[model samples]
Target: MTAPSSPDTQAENAEVIARQRVMRVLAQAPDQQLEELYEKFADKPDWTFARKPETGLVMTRGRIGGGGAPFNLGEMTVTRAAIQLKSGEVGHAYCQGRNQRKAAIAAFFDAAWLSEAHKQSVEANIIAPLEQEQLTAKKDKLKKAAATKVDFFTMVRGDG
Candidate 1:
């Protein structure tokens, strides 16, 4: 048997997850939108890249019909960045395609979002709107997809 995780560990894990979710939303938003959101911050916090944004290829995988055997889909381009705020908070972002600046902005936003100074503004103007946009897009896509979905069922007749 293994020991239970400490409260600190749980909190750390939660923070990591939140950061990842923020990074994902940031990655999906347009650069213009993110930059506009960044303007909401009262005072711009200075940040430096822990690692400069760079592009690379990642192999994507897909499962047959969302189940069964998994197979390699294809290699896709991805950009990643890591930034550290002056106050010592570190942020990392990974985004699809080759947009180094976008990745950097996202990483910087991630770091700034975690800062107590910018947390409320980030949540209100950036994360909330982006999340709502994502949710709307997802719902629309699902509705479209559902329209074409085929459902087949068999009915047992009492007479038969």
Candidate 2:
């Protein structure tokens, strides 16, 4: 016999639906993650996000040694993202600066919305880009640092 849907089951389903929406927003880069929610896909991944030009600032108010006054040290541009997976899984990520992780997770959820047949394609195209970018960035940084290595020389004075 089939079991009836209880209140607890309905609540659980609603929670699941909420999670899917969050994922769609965090999928785009950090800046795009904060977009407004619009449009919903049934067959494809559902949920939407939008972007607003917002400045994120990091300020050092003051310290005990230098507590004379407070000042803004730096600012960053931030974006928020969200995505809904095909299986109704949702994820979100908010980050400072343009970040690929924000986009990959979002794309991952988007791919999750697709049939298993399309998953590999989505992963290779969407997720792979970020991973490749990260690897390249790391290698370049190491190469640059290696190129800047310096040697120190010491001289001794002779006594007459």
Candidate 3:
């Protein structure tokens, strides 16, 4: 018998591996914790912040009114953030909301993910939670929308 196929096994594997790599980098905090990582290279001249346009499309599968055929949604625009540590280490992130603080925090986590020692803590405390939260919110919204689905169908006689 043949084993079942996973359509996105490679992509999922890549994402998981990337997450692991980030985790490992964040585990090498020199200051005893990931939170203090910023001060480690705070004095570096490369440290700076910038704003830019980000774009993405969430390909979602859903039944119209919870019982119809699945369909795709269009793309969306987002704001991206970037921070360069004094040591030339760059942190980047994209968020749906235009919040500076969230961007800063994401950049901080990205920087921590770049650290070899503090990577695990950063993944556990920051990246993982945020990712989970976003997934949960998306699922909830989809479910709610599905609950209110309305179906309309019409039939016509051909050549009476």
Candidate 4:
């Protein structure tokens, strides 16, 4: 009942998806890890703060039983920043907690990812490793939780 997307539209959607993935990884990454990766970059491009890092509280929402009515789960601290590369690419980041430095670094990487010249290196050195580490951590946590899982069964009585 809808028209198919054109090639240009598809390409734009793909670009938006890729940027979303990058931002998701950056937002979930630890501040220490982001700082370390930022330090290791060989060519850090010059960038100006389009918006200075600022901390604020955001209301979080949750659904009851995963599918029921949604409710506010209280507020959590969040920091956000925006940066513009010298070449005109603009990047923005939002992260949990009050780590302004982390937000700035993440915004820098977001802008870097937008630039063709820096995308590959940023993906390889920063995004890939962080993704791998997070994956490993998740697996380990699941494994540990799985170890404690219990199964129960009842024996039937013949007298019935």
Candidate 5:
């Protein structure tokens, strides 16, 4: 067995995990959501992209009942983009569906969040709102699923 990761490594891993969470939330949000966010920014930030937005299929996987065996969930359409801000922060995004503009917007947000000047403002105005909307939607979905759940029970026989 390997020893535990160092404190600095652990912190870096934590940040990576948080970034993943933010990106996942952003990717699932609707295109209009991002469009609104784009309008909220004051001045346009200069950025150079490594490549134009591209769409491709990605193979998705799932585990049987959460943790049993892994299985392929079939291919999904995804759009990806990578960009670097003028200040040198790089960001990337892979979003579900064929909306390349959504991916580019998300990537720009990711890069902007990397800078200390924009971190707090972006997190408050963009990430926080998106995350809250996602959480609310998730709760609504869970409530719908729970409403359809049926409880099965056994009754004892009086003759026994």
Candidate 6:
């Protein structure tokens, strides 16, 4: 048995989960889309790069049949950035691909989200729209795939 988490711990955990969700949406968003959405923020805050955006290869792994033993799939190119806001918030982001600008923008958003003043606006303008777009795209893809699905049934013949 283990001790239950305190209220502060639970709140911290929720914050971490929310941040993860934001990062996931940012990572999946297209570069053009992310840039367009980012531009919506009129008064962008001043920030310095803790770590400038850089591209590198990361090894990917996969499990056989989605359940069996894991195996190294291959390497994937990823861009990552870290930024520190003048207000003392630090943010980091990792995006798949070699788009340095996208990674930087994502990191900026991450840091901005840490600020209580920007959290609600960031969630409303950036996170919500991106998540909706992703959900719509996923639904469209599923609809198309479902349309092509084949159903077959076996016929039985009576024999005496």
**Against the unseen true structure, what C-alpha lDDT does each candidate score?**
0.86, 0.48, 0.55, 0.94, 0.87, 0.92
Residue 129 accuracy (lDDT) in model 6: 88
Q: What is the lDDT of residue 139 in candidate 4?
A: 100
In model 1, the clashing pairs are none
Q: For residues 1-160, what per-residue lDDT tens digits would candidate 2 score against the true structure?
A: 1367689888877766654443433343233332211112123444444332233544434544576556665565554455555455544454455654445445444545344654555445434554455568779999999999988665665751
On lDDT, the candidate that comes out on top is: 4
* Model 5: CA > 4 A from native: 1-3, 64-69, 151-154, 158-160
- The runs of at least 3 residues in candidate 4 whose Cα sits more than 4 Å from the true structure, single-residue gaps closed, are 1-9, 158-160
Clashes by residue pair, model 5: none
85-149 per-residue lDDT for model 6 (tens digits): 99999889999999999999999999998888788888899999899989999999999999999
What is the C-alpha lDDT profile of model 5 across 1-160, one tens digit per residue? 1468899888888898989987887898899989889888766578989767999999999999988899998999999998888988888899999998999998988888887778787788889988999899999999999999998776778853
Q: Write the per-residue lDDT of candidate 1 for residues 1-160, one digit (tens) a residue.
A: 1357698888888887887788889999987777777666567788899999999999999999999799999999999999999998887889898989888888888888888988787777788889999999999999999999989776878864
How many steric clashes does model 4 contain?
0
TM-scores of all candidate predictions against the true structure: 0.79, 0.41, 0.44, 0.89, 0.87, 0.89
lDDT of 4 by residue, 110-141 (tens): 99999988999999999998988888999999
Number of clashes recorded per candidate: 0, 26, 15, 0, 0, 0
Candidates by TM-score, descending order: 4, 6, 5, 1, 3, 2
Q: Worst lDDT window (10 residues) for model 2?
A: 33-42
- Model 1 residue 103 lDDT score: 88
How do the residues 1-160 of candidate 3 rate in per-residue lDDT, one tens digit apiece? 1345376776777766785554334332222333444344332244467544344444546688988987765544434567766555667765444444545545656765666555577667655654565568779999999999988665666852
- Higher-TM-score candidate of 3 and 4: 4
